[model samples]
Target: MSTPELQWFKSSYSSSNEPGDCVEVATTPTAVHIRDSKTPRTAQLKITPSAWARFLTTLPT
Candidate 1:
């Protein structure tokens, strides 16, 4: 019916010096939710756990 409420937290990678440029994450057993901290009301993306893993692997170290 409806999605369960998730506890959101800001990413540590978001530099404290740049509070305006940040992202928030909310995780569930089935998917991960991502949203912009600056404009959260605009849109959000949900990705499967596997897809999230693949995306993470592509990021620079």
Candidate 2:
């Protein structure tokens, strides 16, 4: 299957001008996608709904 085309965006909390440390994220209907900005050709990590919520909860409010 071909890779899905998505509008990748960096997290608002991210503060990196260099692409090496940049992470790009995109949202899909059933998952949240995360990929290294420097390696777009590599595989992306997909997080489930519940896990995504918990991950956000761990972040500072």
Candidate 3:
């Protein structure tokens, strides 16, 4: 099945000048998508909203 195009964005913590250190994210009602900014066409990770929420809890604020 073909996937629809998603609107991707990077975190504010990611510096535009340091493209190599950036990660991009896209979200839908059912899932969240993550990909390396430097290689967008490469493999991407997809997770459910609940999983994404749990992941956020593990990160330092």
State the weakest 10-residue window (summed lDDT) of model 1: 3-12
lDDT of 2: 0.83
Specify the highest-TM-score model's number. 3
Across 1-61, the per-residue lDDT of candidate 2 in tens digits comes to: 8977888898776766664778888888888888998898799999987788898899787
Q: What are the clashing pairs of model 3?
A: none
Against the true structure, candidate 3 has what lDDT? 0.93
State the lDDT of candidate 1 residue by residue for 1-61, as single tens digits. Answer: 9967888889778798988798898889999999998998779999999898998899999
lDDT of each: 0.88, 0.83, 0.93
Task: Give candidate 2's TM-score.
Answer: 0.71
Which run of 10 residues does model 3 get worst, by summed lDDT? 14-23
* C-alpha TM-score for every candidate: 0.83, 0.71, 0.87
The candidate that wins on lDDT is 3
lDDT head-to-head 1 vs 3, winner: 3
Tens digit per residue, CA lDDT, model 3, 3-61: 88899999989886887898899999999999998899999999999999999999998
- Candidate 2 residue pairs that clash: none
